[model samples]
Target: MGLWFLNRPRPIKRTISVILDFLAIPFSLWLAFSLRLGEFYIPPNQQLWIFVLAPVLAIPIFIKSGLYRAIIRYIGMDAIWTIARAVFLYSLIFSVIVLTFNDLAGLVPRTVYAIQAIILMLFVGGSRMIARWLIVKSDHHLWKEVNAVRYIPPVLIYGAGRAGTQAAALMKLSNQMRPVAFIDDNVTLWRQQINGMTVYGVDQLAKLIERFKVRDILLAMPSAGRRRRSEILKLLEHYPVHVRTLPDLMDIAEGRLEVSDIQEVDIADLLGREPVAPINNLLSKNITDKAVMVTGAGGSIGSELCRQIIHLSPSCLVLYEASEINLYQIERELASLALDIPVYSMLGTVLNQQRVEMVCRRFGVNTIYHAAAYKHVPIVERNTNEGIRNNVFGTLHCAQAAIDAEVETFVLISTDKAVRPTNTMGATKRFAELVLQAFAESKTLYNKTRFTMVRFGNVLGSSGSVVPLFRDQIAKGGPVTVTDPEIIRYFMTIPEAAALVIQAGAMGKGGDVFVLDMGEPVKIVDLARRMIHLSGFTIRDNDNPNGDIEIDYTGLRPGEKLYEELLIGDNVSATEHEKIMRAEECVIEWPALVKIIRELELANKHDDCQKARAILLDTIDGFIPQCELSDWLGNDN
Candidate 1:
């Protein structure tokens, strides 16, 4: 019956609290007088009226204090403190009324009022606390009944700062995760209780994991330095908990924090290098107030370029992509940014010269960022005919159209694999570069269009990047694959790559090959090991045979080099930007390049794989085919 009453409507609960305060106020005053007289004495007429009217003053005080606004189940110490203040004020007012009446002055001692104040505070505050405890206990049991199939994931917060505390409070009220404790590097916070959970030092992480069976760890250190954050990630790598983190401080300034804001560790955080701020002048040089168009605008690098382009206040931006879905997605996203500039989404392939010419003419394109290409090495190697047709011929068509339209600047997004290539994708890209270089060499063509190419290494989170592959493999609790133990590759974030591309394009001459300074190359095997460790899992190797994940080396894929090179030759000079460089390499004349394009067109038309391979081998310098003609023949059949 008592449980049912506690669970009644809001009005009933408020009425019950008001009535209790009314009854407790008079009883406390009566007790004070009886104790002062040392007997169970009835109050005199003047004092009786004081006692009876005391509740009237106290009830109004309680209501005005907002004491009943807080729900009992969630009431905390702050709410209890408010009750204390309200009772003290009520007692003081009642005492003033008694003293002013003069007839009730001698009826009760001044000390009785003080005693009544203390007793009233206890009754009022204690009753609320008791109700809160009972409701919380009942709700917890009911929560368990509603969720019988799966237990909530237990979590540990890494930082004990304000962000960490806020995240903990949010997690506690969520059904997806339950915060178990806090792990702080600060010694002063060690072993202290925060919001009911004990804070432990970094050294006690393993012990806490065992005690609580923790499954996930949240990194709430939004302002931690990169080196310190990396150190913490390294320290937690060998444990068995999946790691997640909150966004930086900028996200918090936008709005309130929520449990859903926690995200998986970004690949950039693992790189441990602060990104360089883009130069405002260089970023806005060619883009501001210019008519710009990006082919392959739906691609990883192209899409990023479009996003950054819209912010530069371009007069108009055009997206020319072959894929229907990719073009639609980028179009929708740019439209939502609600920029004042016009965004034209055109459905056309770069391989069609007429279509490229028409779009260039229609838009009066001031600058063209040609990013469309068949970039996947293995896939391109299997389909060599289509790869050459798209990468080589598509670039030729775009260049011709730009020259005809008198587009001021044309930038080609090249790859590190284009240097001394071994595969079809790399050779085709190098051929595309040669095509532009040939155009730059011709005096008449150079006067019409300025063509430049920016070459860089692998971009993390790109379509075929290994970072997402490793993350997916780790999540499945199995063996992660690497091409070769000794293989290495340079990596950069997608945004950084796009920024460098824009800056490089702005600094280009008629036929310059701009190369980005891709930081040190990382070993693939070491990267796999580090990824497993940072996710709180040990490598399954010979030393620790009972590890969580195993690293497997599948032999290198076809046409995949152990390492990639950005510059074709030793003749390289630094540009104005620290990250961009000018590579003074070889180039073919327009006549020679045109002849090679004609041969490629004929070879593709006849479905002659051998002839096409021979053309690439003879045209591109230092070109070597890793697969036999029969290997491609099998794919063709």
Candidate 2:
């Protein structure tokens, strides 16, 4: 019956509080008189009006103070403060009324009014505290009864700041997990209590995990930098607990998310470097009020480029893609995000010179970002002719079209694999770079298009990236395949990469090759281990036979290198942007490059894979075939 009444409608509960306050106010005055007189004294007829006036004055004050508006179960210090102020005001008015009436009807001691104020304050404030306790206890009891069979895991919050306290409060209301304590790096916070959870030093992590049986740690440091987060993650990785983090501070500040909206640790945090803040001037230099187009606009890098470009307020945006579904998806997304900016989605391949040129002319394109290519190494290796046709000739078609349309800027998205190539894909990418370099130097197309190439290594979350592949393999519950234990690759978040690309494009002189500073190389095997451990899984190996995930080294695939390089040679110099550098690498002159393109075109036209391979080997200085030709069609020839 008590629980049912407590669970009554909010208005009914509020009315109950009003009735309680009404009865308590009069009773408090009577108690105060008795205490002051040192006997069981009843109010005389003259002072009887005082009892009625007490409630009449106090109830309205309490209501006006918003005392009843606060939810009883969630009441805090602020509500208590409100109660204090409201009661003091009511006491002052009641004392004046009593003193005036006493002068005419009956004598009332001055001490009685003071005593009444004290009693009334205690009754008003203490009752709400008591009610809050009762409501909280009842809800907790009901939750326990209903979820008796549910097992709520005990977890630790890793910060004791405001975000951490909010997360703790959220945890108390949730049935999924129970917060055990807090782990903080601040020594001053250690051994302190926050939101009913004890803060402990890093040294106490092992003990806390053991004592509480904690299987997860919630990182509530939303404002922490990537390097600091990486340090903390490295420390946490030593434990058996799975880790999750709240979104960035901006997200929380914008009200897009709450501290309790925790997600799996962002893989980018493991990179140990803060993303360089983008320069607004450089970001909008070529894009602002200029008609811009992005090829492969539906791809990982291409889509992110589109998202960033729209925010720069272009005159109009054009999305050119070969895949119909990719074009439609990106077009819909850009339409919503573009707002007032016009977004034109064109479905066509870069291989068609006429189509590519016509789209540029129709859109009045000022800048073109060429991202379409056969990027998957093994897939491209198996189709050498198709790889050359798309990566090399396709790039040629786009550059020629941009030149014909007199586009102001043409930025080619090149890969680290293009440096000192060993695969058909890399060779073709290098060839594509040469195509742009040759065009930039050509006298005939001089000053028509400022051609630039931004070269960088793997981007996290891009299509065919190892990060997602490993995550999927881990989710499936068993073996995670790695290409080689020794292989290492540089990684940057896709957004960061796209931002840098935009900035690099703005900084371009004709034929410039910009290399983005991809911080440090990470070993593939170590990355695999970290992902497994962070997911709360142990690696299965000779050392640990009873582990959750087994990492299997599949050896390097065809054309895959042990490590990737951003520059072909060491002729690199810093640019205005700290993360971007200009590489003074060799380039083929137009006449020679034109001859190479014609030979490759004839080879592709005849499906003569050997002839195409020979042209790439002879033209690209560092091109080295890593294995026998594996082209599915070339094998028969």
Candidate 3:
């Protein structure tokens, strides 16, 4: 019973540490009397009867300081400060009692106050420190070992601040990884140690790597912004060691530190986020107390849009999605949010013109955001016809319905892929942009019915992006695949992408093709290695034999490129939002665009994959097919 009670961490027992301090109140009183006088003296009025009610006075003081709730092991300087403040005030009240009781008995000496206060504080404070010391001593043996049989690996963390220390403690608990050292950028911290791990300078990475044979370096610099991280990544680039980084401070797991939540750094960090200063009034102006509709609401980009829009107090938000499960997932989230505004989950495809028109008319949707498209490169490479139908026709269906419903603003979530492309997916999206560009070109275009497009690069962690692929491969315990390790692409967070889209949609004056200012591109190989390292693994290559993960290059896929360009034409002019730009270029008239779209639609309907590929190349500028045999694909079909 005694062993179990000692081992257990309980709320009542945690309070017991504080209660022990109150038990010393008698000594505190005795010392107070002794200090005011030259020696211990008990007045006739201050007989032992005062000690009987000491617990009553101490309980309020302890409760006021929030001392009872303070766990001894976790107590730090802040708690000590609170204790001092509470004790000083508590002493004043106790002294007042002495004065009041003097009316009943004889007077108490003033020197007694000084001795009592000093003794009381020492007793109360020393008990907590003693408890803390014992707890630390008990856990000392645990701080020395780690799990080798478990899935955990050995790791050395960077930084010794809040983020780093928390990460170290968490890694220890999971027993999946052991933290060997802390590699901080601060020179002063280099010789120091945290949690028994010596801190080293950033420059000593190679030495540390060689000495400990450390497999991975986990960056605990959650406070590091994009620019700083980019600089760090560049410095560490040539080391041939895998690198991983913590998520942005705000995004780190509910502001709690845990090892299982420790994730591999992905490409998002390389494309450091430039904070968005939203045109808030403009964004909330249209949606507030107005009916809003989002097409493709179940998609990664579209779902985020819904999440933000719902918070803006739209009179009613309608989520129009074709996929059943996607709709259910997003709908369940909104339902749980319990917002006052009506949230309707409508099942309907954007490509179904009549279905879209009916929903818009029925819901009285005043605002529309179009985000549906086939985005995968290799998949879209083969299924060219379906890609065009969904990209081009799906967009057309939603746009015309919004027009017929007299919607206020229609924002098309576009991509850098729409830029002059080598792939059919890019060409189809360019054609869709043209579909809006032609509608915007009309002399009859209305200020009320504004249409616009926001173009940016791949979003990190989106359904088809490299981040998830790298993460999954890393988890699978072997080779992490990259298509041409040198392939570079721009990346952004889904929320950042959605924010830009919302801001761009509001900025549009109809038919404007706005491009998001994506920061510098990141190489795929570096991204892979960082992910491997952050996941507590070293990359297997010529330099490291203990590496747990292997990087394999599969060569570029069909219709894919080493890089993608955001600007289709050089005539792009900056917008009000520095990150957004408007592009001016040649456009096929709506008549011609419609003609191409019709043919493309028919090709998809008849399964004429060759004809679909043929029309895509002729219609879109800068498109080149890696494979000429449309018939071979059709046969495989």
Candidate 4:
């Protein structure tokens, strides 16, 4: 019956509420009179009309107060308050009428009105509360019956604050997970009940986990700082529970995401370093109101650069990408952003000197962020000639075009591997940097464009980054591969890297090599372990033979490095932005660098990987091949 009423239409439910209230109002009055007289006293002729008048007056008042409009399944405090106010008004008017007409109404008891009002208030309010419980309970039972085979894992929510309470409420409605309790750092909240779930301290996590068999812990502290979150994650890492988190408070607030929309623990939370707020002046210096062009605009870094640039309100944004699909996706996204600024998406490779120059000239491009290049180390090592042609001559063509178009600023996105360069990709990137440096030096007389290179370590979530690969491996319940136990690399988030790159570019004078201060490098084995553990899995090693996931130590790939460096030498100076620094590195003059680039291009045309390797080794400083040339085409000279 309760389920039938719960599924009824709103009008039918409201009508039922009205009929129930009409019946309860007069019965409450009769009970009040009997209790006041201390007997089962029947009302006299005069007072019989008083009982009939009781409901007539109250019913209209209740209707006006919207009492029947409240849904029994979801009635809250406001609805209860409305009932209270309506009953009080009715009681006041009934008392005034009875006392004023007592002589004519045959002497009604003064205590009767007060007694009946209290009874009526309880009857009206309590029935709705009972109905709400019944409907909700019936609905839950029905849902459970329908999904009897589906297992809903119980979870513990961290942080017994507003977000946690809300998360618990949302979980109650979810079929996938059930929230069992809250774990908070606040000692005062310990053993206290929130939304019927007890809040416990971190020490009780073991008992709670064992008692409830919780396999996941949802982090509900959206407002907590990264350091605090990292500390919490470190504490949780000891337990066998998968950790997920709400997005940052800003993302939740602005994006309309709920606290219960849990996601995998952010990779940045492991870094624990709070990003320094970007300097607005430096961010907008080369971008604001300028015609900016981003080569490889559909790539990870290039696309992020575009996203940030649109907010700064550029006059127009030019996306020059080699891939048709990438260009289409980014263009569609920018169009959705709905900024008044014009966005021009051109499908063209940076390798075409004339095409790049024409785009720059037509767009009156003031700033060019050159980000197009092959970056995967092993792939570039195998495709040696193509890698050189793209990373080396691609940069050359863009730089030359920037100069020809008289573009104001040009920034090349370089990598940490470019420092010592054991891989073909890294060497080509270094060679590209040298090309820009030479151009910047030669243009000292004309000074048409300022060339800057921003070098940083690996960016999390970028294409070919290990973070996603490890996540996929962990999800697949298998061996997570690491190149070497001792291998370590610096890591930064893509957005932060892009913002710092922009700031660094603004600080560039000419021929500047800016090295971003990537935080301490993390060991590959430790990273793999942390990822596995945080994902609620244990590493399968000699000590833990029954562990969930195995760690496979695949020896280093061709041209892979055990460690990466950001600066070529220790001669580095701090820039205006704290995270960005200027490096004093060797630069080949334009005359010498151009000759080497032409030889590389000729070798590339003939598919001579050996000659190309020789040119790169002879040209780039500290260039060493980690493995013999493994070009798909034979490396015969």
Query: Which prediction has more favorable TM-score, 1 or 4?
Result: 4
Clashing pairs in 4: none
Expressed as tens digits, the lDDT of each residue in 324-393 for candidate 3 is: 9999999999888999989899998778889888888898998898987888877887777677778988
Instruction: Show pairs that collide, candidate 3.
Output: 31-115, 32-112, 32-115, 32-116, 36-111, 152-176, 153-176, 243-530
Candidate 2, residue 367: lDDT: 96
- Candidate 4 lDDT, tens digit per residue, 484-526? 9899999899999999999999999999999999988988788
The TM-scores, one per candidate, come to 0.80, 0.87, 0.88, 0.85
Lowest lDDT sum, 10 consecutive residues, model 1, at 628-637
Error of 1 at 498 (Å): 1.3
What is the clash count for each candidate, in the order shown? Answer: 2, 0, 8, 0
Candidate 4's C-alpha runs over 4 A off are 10-128, 143-149, 250-260, 444-446, 630-637
Model 4: lDDT of residue 272: 83
What's the CA error at residue 452 for candidate 4, in Å?
1.2
Q: Rank candidates by TM-score, best first.
A: 3, 2, 4, 1
Give lDDT per model, in order.
0.88, 0.88, 0.77, 0.89
Task: Compose the digit string of candidate 2's lDDT tens values, residues 5-115.
Answer: 687999998998899999999898888878988999876676577778889899999999998899887788888888888988887787777666646334677777778
Clashes of 3: 8
